[model samples]
Structure formats: C-alpha cells, structure tokens
Target: MYALENEGGIKKVKKLDQFLQDNLNDLRDRGLYNEIDPVEGPNGPVIKISGKELINLSSNNYLGLATNDHLKEIAKHAIDQYGVGAGAVRTINGTMDLHVKLEEKLAEFKGTEAAIAYQSGFNCNMAAISGVMDKNDAILSDELNHASIIDGIRLSKAKVIRYNHSDMDDLRAKAKEAAESGLYNKVMVITDGVFSMDGDLAELPEIVEIAKEFNLITYVDDAHGSGVMGKGAGTVKHFGLSKEIDFQIGTLSKAIGVVGGYVAGSKDLIDWLKVRSRPFLFSTALPPGDTAAITAAVQMIMDSTELHDQLWENGRYLKEGLLKLGFDIGKSETPITPCIIGEEKLTQQFSKRLREEGVYAKSIVFPTVPQGTGRVRNMPMATHTKEMLDQALAVYEKVGKELSIIN
Candidate 1:
C-alpha cells in the first residue's frame, strides 16, 4: 500500500524509500549526513580508517579496555575453555558458569542485591524498564535521556512525561503531577546518569531526594557513568547515594571495554526481568569470552582506581587545552567533551575539516540535539598518551582558526 504524505495530499508515496531519500537529501543539503568508515586497527586514541591512521576521539572505549592486553588475555583464556557462543538464550540452556560469575561480579561492583545481564545497554533499558512497569505505570523521563530509554518506555505502554533536562524543579513538578494524576499504579523517574552528548551528569542527589519525597521508583542509566565516575562504580556511588536508587542500568561496553549491559537492583527486580524481559529470554547469552572479559574488567575497576584517575586526568588536560584555545567546550564535567558549534552545517563542516586534518571527532547535529546546538563530541580514553593528546590539540587549534570557530 502506498503511504500518503498527508491526509490532505493527493499524492501517494513509497513510504520507506521516499522517507529515506527525503531525510537523506535534507541531511546532505544541511551537511549533516555522515557515511560510516570501518576502523582498520585497534580502538586506541589513534585508529586506522580507510588505510589512514587518524587521531580518534569517536569511540566509546572510555577506559581503553577494548584493546587492553589484560582484557584480551582473559577473553582468550575463556574462549579456550568455553568455545565461543553460549548457543541459546539464558533460560533455554545458555546460562553458562561464566554468565553467573559475571553477574556476581557486576552485583558486587554496583553494590546491588543482584544483577541481570542483557545483550546490550540498549536492550538492558528495553528489558529492565519494560519488565518492571507496563501499561498501568507512568514514566517521568528526562528530556535528554538516551534514545534507548525513550524506545523502551514506549514499548512498555506507560504514560511518559518528560521533564526538562537535569532540571530538578521540573522533575519534582512532573513527579508530583504524575503521582497525583492517580491514573497509574506505579510512577518512575528515569534519567541517564551521565548524558552522553552533553557530558554533563544527572542531578542524582536531587533526583534521589525527589524520589524519596514522592515515593517514586528511581532508574539511572549509567552507560557513560559506570567506568568514569565514583571510583569506577557509577554516579550513584559517586554521590554516595547508591542505596536510594532502585534500578541501576550500566553497560559493559564503554568503560568495561566489552559488550553487554546489566540491571542491578533488588533480587526481586532481577528475578522479574529473567522471566519477563523478552531480550533475556529470547536472545542468545553473552559468549564466554565476553562474559569473562567483563568480569576481569569489573574486578580491575574495583581493585584500584588507576584507570579512572588516568581517564579524568586525560579529560581535564584536553578540556583545559581546548578551552585555552578559545573554543566553547560546553559545560562538561566528565571526559565526554563537546565542542559546541551553534549551527548544524558549521558543526558538520568543522568535523569534516578536523577529520581531514587528522582528528576523528564525529559531529552531532539537528535532531540528535536541538536545532542549533550541534557539536563535535570528543571522548578521551584513559590510555591516551600526552603526545597523542598534544598532537590532537594542535590539529584542533589549527582547524578551529581556519573554520573561524576560535580566534
């Protein structure tokens, strides 16, 4: 069936195909369309893309564990013992010993009663939030919460009320409204512990206080916060308010340098997810190697704060250097820095110019953010060397002046 652009329009259109062309053309015309390139080498601060080595700030390898020899060795050893995939979903005979161990380590690291792993951080949101609250519940989401959350909440059939980003007052107001609406059996306040794009942290302390005052269920997606904040535990631990939050969602991908996500909460919560979370019940379990590698990474994070310290040092160094060069680095408290460019086209051009000049920071624009708040996000990994950062800063300075983004 042909899809009509508008009910009043006489023209019928190939909805999927026409939709893609229209969107792509619009993006390209605005200089916001990007073509993905494969990484040829390790995901270090420098990566080989299209046979050219570039100073890479585009990856999410926060602690540099993605390419660390220690994690590699552990994963290899696990593979030798367990032989790749678990071959089925967790419930249907894919729950390996390694899976249980990983969950145990994750629970210990997060200081939660129990933990349940999923295929990805995205799926964790899908699984956990949907498993807990359904059509009868209300979700008070932060305006800038990750897309996974928006989708997961949508899937749950819950009434989603969005509050202004990190505005505690707005959150409190929304909570009061949702609570008093008396239209739902449960009320949840959800936010990203560290907003990935802005690099700003959630007001967890205030959120916890609000949750306590309103008797709301609290959920913090710590995808960016897990290995970066709170001595490598998360934002909840960073604020010393772990016990106040009900559901803590984290990724094994970014800082843990592996692939997977988890929800840490009361034992009952995890139990509910196991039975009801579709992803966990239908998707294949994490391979032994990934599970073991994650376990090792978590242990390393808990055993010492060295990686976390290094990451912050690198972040501060880059932030200070960029700021000194007269660039608007935005208000970022974490290592995820964004060089805000007020216009979408300029931001995309700036990113392209940087890539040409040997830095690989990606540009975010338009719908990803607001209409005018486009930026190039720079993620500094713990393993970035002084020389690497210095080189990148020099390139940035040169490009900034050429593009008139700085003096």
Candidate 2:
C-alpha cells in the first residue's frame, strides 16, 4: 500500500489521486463547481440554510407537500404500526401489506393495469430498462434522458441509438434503422415527458405515432411531468394517450413528496419487473411510513387538483415576473423554470448573489447542461404566496442588474 506522507520517496500523490484532482480542477475552471450547504430547516419554498432564511428555488418538492401535516400524521401512524425499516428485500421478508397498498394506489393514480415500486425514480429507470432489454436488443433513447436512464441503458447490454431530443423525424429514422437491421430481438424507444434541464416537453404524441409505425416498445420517464401535468396523474394522461404508451415511469420523490419510484404499464410488464428487476429483487421495500405517506399523496393528487393548480399558478407568476424584469426565463412550460445566464462563472455568481439576497436559487453549469447555457434552476412550489414570488422577482432583478445580465 502507498503511504500518505511518502510514496516511492516522492511527496506527490498517485495517478488515481490525480484523477479526482484533475476532474475537480476542470470543474472549477469551467465554473461548474458545486458546494453542499446544510439546510437548517424543513423543505418548503422558503427554508433556513446555514442560519439564513432564503426562498428555496432548488428543491424538487413541487407541490410543497414534503412537509405537509397530513402526510406527516399518516407517516407517524404507519411508523407506530410497522416500525422504521423494511429489514429485507421485497422478495425476502420486506414486502409489507403497506407496500402492496401503495402500489395499488399508484396503479389507481396512474390509471394503469398494474404498478411496481422501486426505491427511487433513478432506480425505476435502472430496473425497468435493464429488466426489459438485453444485449440482443436495441434501445432508441432521447438525447436528454436522465443520467439514471443513461446508466440503466448501459447496464442493459443493449445497443443504444441516441435520437435528437424530441425530434420525431430523427426518432423515426433511428427506429426504422434499428428495426430493419433485424439484429436485435426487441426495440424500445424511451423519452422523458419533461426534459429537466430545458423544461420543454417531449413530443410524446408524435413519438407514440412513430413507435406504432416502427413496432417499438414505448417508455416515458415522467419524473418531472407527473403531478404537475396530466391533471396530476402524468404526461400520459396529459396527452390523452395513456393506453398507447407502454411503460410509464415516474418518481414519488418529486411531486409525491415521498421517497420511491414506480412503473405503470401492462400487468405483464409489472409482473416481469417484480420477478427480474435487480433493484426490486435486491433492495428493501419502502418503509411502511413512506408507503402510507405516498398512498395519501397519490389519493390527494387523484381526488383534488388543488396542489397542481396552485403549482401552475405559482410557476406562471414567477416566470412572468422574471420575464418582465428582463431575465431570460428559458423555453419552459412547466414549473421547472430556468433563468438562462450566459457564462458559467456569471451564473454561479448570480446564484450566490441571489442567496445573499435571501433567495436560494442554485446555479447549474456545463456537463449538467451545455456550455454557455448555464442557468439558475428555480422550481416554485405550490405553497409559495404571491408575496413570496414578488420578493424573489425583486432579488432576481437586483442580481441581474448587478451582474449586468439584465439592464
């Protein structure tokens, strides 16, 4: 083993150590460096971070339900009945009745034949994509699919063909080529219902039409679209094409304000995942408290669109205010708005300035997005008041002017 103080009589570190240093250096050079700040309070539109109260614009708690009283009460009751941990994988002794109840609730919420739960939205991608496709199959994936989906596809041992983001012509060409090659046993076309980076929606209806033409198995990762779109169900419901899309993947972590993932599809697909998906088989099921909380969240989403409506109202108000303030709110239709800042350094500076002004917007730089496309990603929660939005807009205006990002 190499000694820390001296290695081969040299004071320098090894090549492996250089790798991390080099990567971090590159990040710093490009102004993409990230720093973790401790959140001192609950997750809401406004939170106390490092003792400063800032309007939180970086969280995925879309409906502000993460800290809801009702959900908390349900979780506490479940903990009393079922304890804290699952203790084993679902296939072993971890599958509780609560798990079944949540899965059933999800199916009802998604209006699908069946649904199976995983530990996260990321896990859902890994489990579903890898479970379905193998080395002999080919996957037609959107260029901007989530990192989890990319890793999942890599694990599948499938030939991945990247299509231009939401380009139906490109998707059709790739799908046709894959199908005509006949070298693969299955063809799966996957896309995100809402691109997280840009917030522009996927052309699902057109993609579905192309899927029909190419006999491709369709997959929609609605991680950012669910609960906000589809009338609080999902993008599939938004497009009125739920029956046409084969696999519907969503996150409970985001809109549901809980921790887990699920796949809504045909009963056969759910059955196959329950049996073969590595995450499903290897990981402990969600705890009873999370399961019960998730069930309440889903039922709340299904029964009333209050949260969804409020979220949209907040989104619109924020976007309009930013635009009026001469800030470039990018091509976003959903609550996931990004105020585009040209250079990565300035973007980071802008975010820092916003934080100093009591607004907790985070800067996203290259690698997470393309260079020269850095942004301050703001997700306005349903619980945000008009007063809060107005205050955030004022901060953005001040920061924008200070940085010369706006006149």
Model 2, span 203-318: residue lDDT tens:
98899888898899999999998898988998889999989989999999999999999999999999999999999999888988999999999999999999999999999999
Q: Give me the candidate number with maximum lDDT.
A: 1
Model 2, residue 354: what's the lDDT? 96
In candidate 2, position 253 carries an lDDT of: 92
Local distance difference test, candidate 1? 0.92
Q: How many residue pairs clash in each candidate?
A: 0, 0
Per-model TM-score versus the true fold:
0.95, 0.97
Q: What is each predicted model's overall lDDT from 0 to 1?
A: 0.92, 0.91
Q: So what's the TM-score on candidate 1?
A: 0.95
Error of 1 at 21 (Å): 2.6
